[model samples]
Each structure stands twice: as structure tokens, then as C-alpha cells.
Target: MSAFPEFIPSKLSFHLDSRLVTAVAVAAALYYALYRLQKVKIHPNEPPIVASKIPFVGPLVGMVLDGGRHVKSIGLLNRDKPIFTLPVPGSRIYVVTDPALAAAVQRASKELSWTPLIPELTKRVMGLDADTVGVVAQNLDPEPDEPHGFLADLHDMVYAYLGPGESLNALSLAAARELGRQITAHAAQLEQQSETVDLLAWVQHFVTIGTAQYLYGPENPLARDPRLEQAFWDFDHGLGRLLLGFAPSLVARKPYRAREALVAGLEEYLSAGRHEVGAAPIVQRRIEIAHLHGFSVAATARSELSFLFAGIVNTATSTFWTVLQVCARPALLAAVRAELAAVVEETATGERRLSMEALKGACPTLHAVFLECLRVGSDSYTSRLVKNDMLLAGQWHLKAGSVVQIAGGVLHADPGIWGADADAFDPARFIRLGEGKVLPAAFRPFGGGKTLCPGRHFATHEILAFVAMIVLTFDLEAVHSDENISVPPKEDRVLPVHILEPRTDVFVKVRVRDARAVVVV
Candidate 1:
């Protein structure tokens, strides 16, 4: 039998179908009309909206694809505007591009607060349970008469330890001492012979170990197991997706796995009583505070992961860039080396030591180089959720439930603040500005106000120490074909961060200096 049926219509069944075509066209037009209506409605009192061609969907998609670069592009396009609104599907982000407005946003701590997001981050990113999240959420925005809660206590504790005082000095010195020891050991290994290395990787490895050993003590998990260190970085790279909390195991598989490994290691560290034995006082206090707030040992460990990340990641990246900036430039390197030599002294036993205090206070040229590095290299966003409708700079109106992000990268690039050479890397920029002239308020590397980084003192000390050690003890030459060594382009497209990381590895030849030949003391 034939497969085809003879009764099938050849011509009668297929007509022009003008009616169906008309219906499709009408539906598409109507759908687009509603889509346009759904776009953000701006009031005269509100900051002017910078609308995307694709309405609400475009801004969100741009953020998902470009990370912080999208914000920077929008900023560059609207450099004259101090503030503008970016509307996404669910919310509006008021981007503050002007340094004055940025300062205002930070000053309005109660109206535009960072505390509101802490619970969400603790629950979703740190994997805390609902009860623990509730504990954190309580009194987040307490009334005038209401007593301050867990969050307040945590803040006070952190500030007490990390603020500019005796505790801060001890912590900073400990970190510096640990890093110095690592540098000395590494230099000894390179004696009389050059070793080629990926500069950023080399910096990250030692910084991670040095910072962790001091913060988490001898039983530091990252130092004990190298795999955990790799895992921590993997998790950091995928942090944007992880923050969304949308089935991370499926969407961000590698980062999710890495997070699990870190959490497990942290749990083991805490459970085995390693923290009590040799961990930093702040670390011990952190564990204690979490337990005080009804957190389980596992949840406490998970919470500690955020601390570990904050402790080392940006410091490592900043140190890498600072070292690169100084060493890549011959004159700057020579100047920094000479300045560092003032801090080096020899005891009666012939043991040489680099004075941490002198490095912090006496080395003006080195300090300038470090500050210039931060000014040009920092790409962080200082974000606050607008808790109440407020007037910023007594002009632009910010609505409640919206976010106000002070774009540090955009501000850093403002020629008005940083001079015409804002985009260029000038090691002497800070020195040129000098003490009599007030530095621009746009230089917000450590952020500002209540949300300012408490660890700033420690990070500054540790980075300077690392750089001083390297500059004094070794010679770093870029392993490049060209005679002039170039610094690597920044990895701007990664996670929105305080420090921009290098996009590519820079290979450099490291040669240890002869102790007898070098001018020390």
C-alpha cells in the first residue's frame, strides 16, 4: 500500500491565511507597547534616568555580562552628571559619579544604610540558616529608643580590634612579621641564581600563606592544604553569580564546589580547636561572637569564610600591582629602593631588619607610589540601600528600596579631581600633590563612613612590608623580549572588587642580592 492518502487536500486546505498573519502582527505591537509602559517612571524630583534602548531588561543584562564595567561605561558617557538613575527589572540604582555627592551618600548613614543587606548576604552567600539570618536581621535598623543588636555588637567588636590603636598595631605588626619571614626564606632560595615566575601568582601564593598563617594561625587551612587556596580563588571568581542565590550548584558549579570545600576546611579548623591555640585575637573573638549569637559551629565556620576572603584577596591583588608599578619603572624602583634603605638597620650580631615603623612613616616616595597605585587601580563600588526617601547633596532625590552606589572607579577617573593625568600611572602623583594641598576626596580606596573598611590599617602595613622586603633584598626584571618591561592589563571584567587584578600573568626574573655587597644599616 502507498504511504500517502489520495484523499489529502492539495489546494483547498492551504489558503492565504491573511487573518492569522494580521493577528500575529497585532499581538506583537500590543506586547511591545506594554513593555515600554513597564519601563521606569521618573519624577521631576528624582535623579534623571539614563534609560537603555531595551527598557528594563537592558541594564540588568549589561550588569550580568559586564560586571562593574557596565557602570563605568555609563559613568564615562555621563561624566558631567554628578548623579543618574539606572533602572533594572526590580529596582533602580542611583549611580553617584561626583565626589561631593559620594561623600553625601556616605554621610546619610541612617537614611542610606549598608546594614539592611547584611542578612541577605549572610543567608544566601554564607549559607546561614533562617534562624541565624533572623539573628543578624534583628535591630539592623533599630529605632532611636531600641537597643542595638547583634550587628551592632559585631561592628563594635571589629572596630575595637581593627581601629587605629594598640590591637590594630599588634595585628598589623604580626602580619608584617609573618610576610617578612616568607620573603626572607624565598630570597634565600634564589641566592646566586635567578628564578623566573608569574609575578601575580608568586605574590598571591605568599600573601595568602602569610596573611592566613597570621590571621588563622599555624593550623590555617589554606596553608595546610594548597587545594583550599585554589578553591577559595575559584569561589571568588564566581562570586557575582553566587550572590544571586539562584541554584548556584547548577549555575555556578565550580564555585559552588569550591565554596563547599572552603566551608568544610573551616569547620575542621574550628572543630579541632586550632583557633584557640594560635589564631589572631580577632579571629577568636569572631568565633566567640558567632557562638554567642546562637550560631552552630558549622555556621560560624561558614561565616568565617567571608572574613578570610576580606582579609587576603584585595591585599594580595594590591600588593601585586604596587610591586609591579615600582619595579617595572627603573627610576621609580631606584627611588623606592633608596627610600627603603633608610629603614633597614643591622644589630650588633649582624642580623639585618627592616623597620616597619620607618617604612610606614619615613618613606615618602614609597608611600606616594603605594597611594598612586590605589588611586589608579581601585575599582570598588561603595553601595548603600536607601532605607528612607532622602535628598542627596540637598538636591537629587533618592527613593527608599533603591540602591545608591558611589562609583569609585568613575570618581578616580575624574580629571577634575585626579588631574588631567588621572588615567596615567604616575608614581610621583601623590608626592607632587604634597601635604599643604588637600588630596581630592575622590580618593576613596578604603571607602568611607560607617561602611569604611576596618582592616585598612592592617592591609596598608602588610602591603608596605611585603614591597619593602622585596625591594631591599632582590632584583626583579621582567622576562620580556623588549628591553622595557610593561605591566599587564587589569582583569576588569572579573567580580566587582576593591582592587583590580591583572588580566594576564607577568613573568619576571628574581635574583637575590648579596648580603655582604648591598648597602644596609
Candidate 2:
């Protein structure tokens, strides 16, 4: 303790230094007190008291922590109410849940605009610059001067390549059937060899092949090429990154390297076709549309990838859930099979195969089951930015430029809209004109209003046909009986990625059923 020397101060000197320290402390306290008083004066908590503890970055951090579950939970908290305010970075967003409010938002499309945050995030991920972003933004907006040329061109392009009069539907149907046969054949081969394969991976492979055939044509390399097979796998892996608003800068710096690989392949494909104009109608059409609308090559590629993501991912998930639900509920399975038997018998061609019309009318119960699956499992949410200050939900007054969103998770399960058994997975709930009546406009799996998905009819037909064919041709049973095989619980965070994925890994032991032995309804 005495290793160091110390000098002792006089009592008078200590007292003098202490007084100086007290004066400095008093001045610091006065400055802080005044600063707090000034802050309170500048920023006041307005009506619809949204708490903002940290400015500009608080809500963003919160949403990231739980992947937007907090936003959905806020909606659930105010389900019965029309509107509530949620604090987002630099602004307060109103969460609207009431049907009337939703309708009002839909109707006021001119006054309100779809939030650009998501689209902006997508652009960032896709490496789009300011000019490309502006073009896409203009294209998405409903403008009086724009004349709907882009949309019209897109429709005609789809019609030309995949429409009823062209070879599109025939080609699509052939592709679907061939892919189905290939999948079943593979399954049979696996069974013969005593292989316990992953059903989900197999389904993904089937979907990837089928979808690639439809999009790029049966002659396209991706349809059969093994190297391009890895592209689909990469694309599938990149889907989560695309959806979760993963920062573009991160994608640019990450290991996935999906964007670079896809772009390189697409460029090579396009360059080889420069002298072969009109060789591929769909590809040509896409390029033409992009050029017409002044979108950059990258933007066009992103748009195509957007379509790929939407079609493959959602369809795969829906089909996966549909198969799982049917296997778990044997009564529902039997009902669908009985319906398929009658329809297939009446419409069987000389080849004893199901026709398009037969598939269409296969079973009311099957349709109900598909609808219920959609209602129970759909993961899309709708959002719009207010253009003018207005009162919402009869209470909260939102300012211009404020963002409002409706959580589909909460809306789909609202007791007031869907009755007391809203959360129950009952196919009869949607069976119109039979055992159960169809619900009202509240069931919006494809969304509602002017911007409703144009591909709804096609998507529905595809899903229904796939489900009916599977049920009619195969006997499916869940491998895990105790796993609560209904659609995965909505609130479970462990299944967040499941929203965009089909539970393909959930094994449903399947065996081919003889068509003749099955009883007709």
C-alpha cells in the first residue's frame, strides 16, 4: 500500500476546490433541463398516440426482429376496430382491418397509392438503378396518359404463346401430364429399389420441370438440362431472400451469388437468339414488352423472375398443403376420390385418360377442399399509401403520405367475418349450393379490387387439376399420425419460411390406385 508516495492537501484548499466542482455540476444540470424542455416544445404527441421511443429506426428494427409479426399482431389487437396507428420509421402507419375500410381503400385507388417500399426493396435486390425504378414505378401506377399499352401487350403476349387458340394450352396440358407421369414413374422406380425418398424434394423437382416446360417451352434447355437444373435450385433458394426484403447491398455482397448466375444464363440465352427473332414467342414477347415500356434488361429479368417466383413458389406451397390436408383427413379424401371417379368415367378418352373438361368438373368437394386450403394457408398482405389526409376506421385521421396495411393473416381468421369457426379447416365452409354454402366477398385469397391478380383463373385451374389428378391416381396417407398434420399453425415462428414453401418434407406414403376398382359417387 505504501509503494507509491502521496501529497496531502490542506483543509482550506480542499474546501475551495469542492465549491468550484459544485458550480460546474450546477451549470451542466441547467443545460440538460433546458434541452429537455425545448424537445417537448418542438415535438408533441398528436391524436392516435403512436409511441416512438427512438426516432427513424425503431419500427424498422422491431419488424426485422420478428419478420413483421409485430405488425400483424398489432392488427390482431385492433381486429374489431376499424383503424389503429402503428409507428414506423419516420412516420406513423395506420393499420386498417374493417371490411368497409378495406373497400374504401380499394375504391380510392386514385387517391391512394400502393406503397413503394416493397417494390423499392425488390429493385434494390435486383440491382435496378434510379431510371429503371422510375419506369417500373410509372408502369405500376394507373395513369391516364399511359393508355394501358404495357398490360395490353402482356395479355396479348400471353395469349399468343399460351392462349386457348394457340398451342399454349395444349402444350401446357401435355407438359403437365408428361411431368405427372414422369414423377409417378420415378416414385415407382424408387419404391421398386426400396428407397425412402423425400417427397417434398421430389415434388419440387416435378414442379420445377413442369413449370420450366410451360415457361420456356418443351424444347428449352432448362426443361431437360442437368446444368440448368442447378439454376432452378438456386432460384428456389433465392426466393426467401427475395421476399424478406433482404437488403440489395447484402445480395450484392453475399455468398448466394444467385443474381449474377441467373443474369449470366439469361444473357447467354438472349444473345444466342439475337439473329433468331420470333423463334420463341414468350421470350420474344417479354423482351418486346420490356423494350416498349423502357425497362432495362435487368428489370425485365427481375420481372420474369418475379413471375417464376410467384408461379412456382405459391403453387408448390398450395399443392403441398392440399396434399397434406387430404392425406390427414381420410373422409375428405374419399369424397374427392368418389367425385373424380364419376367425372373420369364420363369423360375418359379412348386412351382412358382424364380430359380437361373432366378435370374441370371432377368434384365440387375437391374444389371446396382447394378453396379451404387457400383460405387457411394464403400469406399475402395488402398495403397502400394515403395520398390525402382523411379519417380512417371512423376514428384515426391519417395524413397524406401515410402507409396503411391490412394483415391477411388476421383478416382471414377474423371471427366476425368468417364466423366462430374461422380458424377451423373445414372444406364444407366454402362448398356452395350443397352441404355448405359459399362465404361472402370476405374470402380473398387472390386479393380484391381493380388490381386483383390477373392470373387467378389460370392459377386456380392449375391447382385444382393437379390436386384432382393426384387424388384420383394415388392413395395418399400421412407418415406421421401424431404430428398435427393440418396446415402448420399460423402463429408458429418456426414455420415462417413455410408461408412461402410447401411442406414437401412431410412424407405422405403413396401407392397407385387402380382407376377401375374405385367406386363412383
Candidate 3:
């Protein structure tokens, strides 16, 4: 007792320690109570809320960890239900899993509008300056009496130039011709010896060069400097961090630097009048519109970054998947080759030429393969901002300012909509229904409503043409121990993307056919 006297606790000290513990517990309980009180209350008229273990923090953490796939996880919780509410910190995202509800969302485009989100997207994604963003924001939703605003006019112009007609046909023919030239030139090199390449890398290289040359004319920045092509991809790789807008220069430094380089390249390209010569008519019209708005050349060039992204990124990714899927299956490859042969015509000079019209409209198996790839390979999200509190489908009341999302992955995988084998990669899914069947509402690879992708036709022609040339001209085999070609798993952590890229590269050995036939588009 005498040796340990200093370590002994007095009754008074014990009482004070107990009092402190009680006070801390009381404070924690009160704080938690207030936190629970602050959460949004679900009314009877609103969609049922998916409960989280940690209240306000769970959904936020899920999104932070899962990226675009978080919605799919939440969706799994209520697979039987069509729609449900997910509460994150300071926001509510209503996820629609049912195709019927998605159709309804499209019908309510004005009320659940994508226009309201454009200014924010421009500033964060396109890096547009405040004044330029302001120009884009004008007349986002013009009244009946008001003159049409920039957004409306831009939409009208895009439809005029990109919609089905001679203008779209001209653009398609240009891309097809350029891609055919690239493939033919590459085939000549492969004739002597087999070349091993990363399938995705090779696809990106050809697609970027060919598509950029067509859209921006011969003097396109990407074609002039190869480094800018890498820069654009680097920026694309780090897109998720850039989209979050949390001190991008520090957190996403590489992509930010790459973005700056692209902006400068485009600025120089526009200043030099390169776009004036052979650029696509739609691209030329876009420049004219920018000039009419009194936008500075720098800002106008920055705005073109969006156009570049829309045209190149998804198109290349989709092409990679299409080629991989077709090459990996010998039966599918044979079918594609046979179908393409029918459309390819032998010329007087012994050169073979493919008409874009026949390739797009006549190839049944090829078209089905294209549609199936989009259905299974895409993970796009269609988002709409609720303008005001309104009843959705006369049942669920969505609050003003909440975001509504329709995840393509979730919809595409629903067995109820796509049948029992929804998850399987079956190209025959479309062929079984009938050739030229209108795509169901459930197919959302291009998204839906007023924000449907305007470049869909051009992108389709490019992909179909590239795949047709590659499968017919060269023999591709996976460079691996296994005889069967292996398909890589997709990258799932990125958000706000139409296509989910392959996680790993599939290297293949390419050898040209012995006949050495030339293909002219």
C-alpha cells in the first residue's frame, strides 16, 4: 500500500471522471438526434426511401467508393420496385429502374430538364470561362413570347446539320474513306510480317486520327501533333476527378495540364483558320455561331473541347468493344465477314469499294452485333434536374432541385425487360427479333429525351466501317497461352461516361490476308 500510494484513486477524482463520461455521452446522443432530424422526411406520396445503416453518410460514401456503379448497388436493394429514393448529403437522387418509368421521365423533359445543368457542366467539364458560360446560359428555357435562346438555336442547328440528309451522309462518307485508307495502309505493312499490338491502343490510334481529320479538316490539331492525342486521352482517363471540381489543379494535376495543352492547341488551330477549309459543315456552323455571340477565340476554342470529346471518346471505346467481341468469336467473325462481302463491290481496276449506304442499311448480322455490344458494354447515365416539386407518374412526388438518374447498366440487365438471358453477350438477341427492328425503349446506350446524343449516326458509321475493314482484311489472334481469345473486364470506377472501357489491354497478333486486295470506301 505504501509503495503504490501515488497511483491510488481518490473518491472525489472517481466521481469527477464519471461525471465527464456522462456529459460526453449526453452530447453525442443530442448531436445524433439532430442529425436524424435533419434528414428528409418521406411523405406517403413520395417514393419509398432506401434506408442506410449510417443515415446521411452511407449513400455519400457508397457513391464515393463505387463511382457510377453505386446506383446499380442501390438498385439491387429494391429489384422488385420500379423506383426508389437515395438520400445523399444535401441531395436526393431518384433512381428509375423500370423502362416504363424511364419513358415517363423522357416525356417530362421540360419539368425534369437537363438544360438547367448545362452551365455547371460547361464550367467544370469544358473549363469554360464565366462570360462564355453566361453566353451558354442565356435562354436555356425561353418562354413562348421570348425569342429562341442560344441553347435552342444550337439544338436546331445541330439537328439541321447532323440529322438524316445529305449533310450527315457527307460526314459519314468522309469518316469511312479516312478509316479505310488507314486500314489499307496498315495492312500493307502487316503483309510482310505479323505485328503484335494492344487491341484497344491500335483502335484508338486509327479512330482518333481518322475521325479528327474528318471533323477538323486536314490540318486538325490531333493529326498535326501526335502528343496532343495522348494529352486528350490522359485528360479522359482522369475525367472523374476533374468532374468533381475539388481543386482540380492540385488533385487532378496531370489531367488538368493535359486539358490546358488541348485548349492551347485548339486555340492555335482556330486562330490559323484551319477550320475554314475542309472541316465538317456542322463544325463550321458551330464556329460561326460562336463568332456571332462575340465570344473570344480562346473561349470559343475551349468550347470546341466538348465537341472533340463527344466525337472521339465514346466512338473509339465502342469500336474497341465491337472489334473485340467480333474477333473473339469465330462464328460471329465468319458471319460478319460473309455479310460484309455481299456489300463490298469489285471495281474495274481490281480495287474493292464499300458504300456507306449499303453497310449501314443492308448488313443485318453486323447491325445486330453493334446493337448487342452497346447493350452489354455501355454503362451510361441519363440525368435530369427536377425544376420544381411535382408528382412523377401521379404517384411519387419529387422535390425541386433533386436529380433524377436512369442507369443504363441497371436497365440493360433487367431480366424482366431483356428476357432471361439479359446478362449474356448474345449478338443474336436483336437478330432473333428481326432485322431492322426498332430498338426498344429499354436500350439506352445513346441515352434518351432532349439530350439524346446528336453524333450517333456519324459515330455508328465510323464504328461499323472500321470493324468491317479489320475483320475482313486481317487475321487477329489473342497473344496468349490459351487458344481461345479472352475478353477483358471493364473499368467500372469512372463516372459520367457513356462506355465502360476494358480494364486491361488485349494484345493480339495481326497478319494481313495473302490476297493483298485494296479496300476503297
lDDT of each: 0.81, 0.58, 0.81
**Which digits, one per residue and each the tens of the lDDT, describe model 3 over residues 468-515?**
878878888877637867888787766748588888878898888633
Clash count per candidate:
0, 1, 0
lDDT of 2 by residue, 285-311 (tens): 677787789876666666665555555
TM per candidate comes to 0.92, 0.77, 0.93
Order the candidate numbers by TM-score, best to worst: 3, 1, 2
Clashes, model 2: 1
Q: What tens digits encode model 1's per-residue C-alpha lDDT throughout 1-521?
A: 35345335433344335656788889888768746654546566688888776667777788788878888889989998899988876778999889778878877888999999888986767778788888888887677588776787778899889988888888877887787777777777777888889888889888888878999999988877889988988888878888778988898888889989999999999999988878999999988888888888888888899899999888888888888899888898888888866667766765567666787788888888888888877878888998878788778888889998988889888888768988898867777777646334477789877878888887888788878877777788877646666787787775566588877878898888743221211
Candidate 1 vs candidate 2, lDDT winner: 1
- Residue pairs with clashing backbones, model 1: none
Best by lDDT: 3
Point out where model 2 deviates above 4 Å.
Answer: 1-58, 115-119, 139-175, 184-195, 219-221, 224-256, 274-284, 295-299, 346-350, 391-396, 432-441, 480-499, 502-504, 514-521
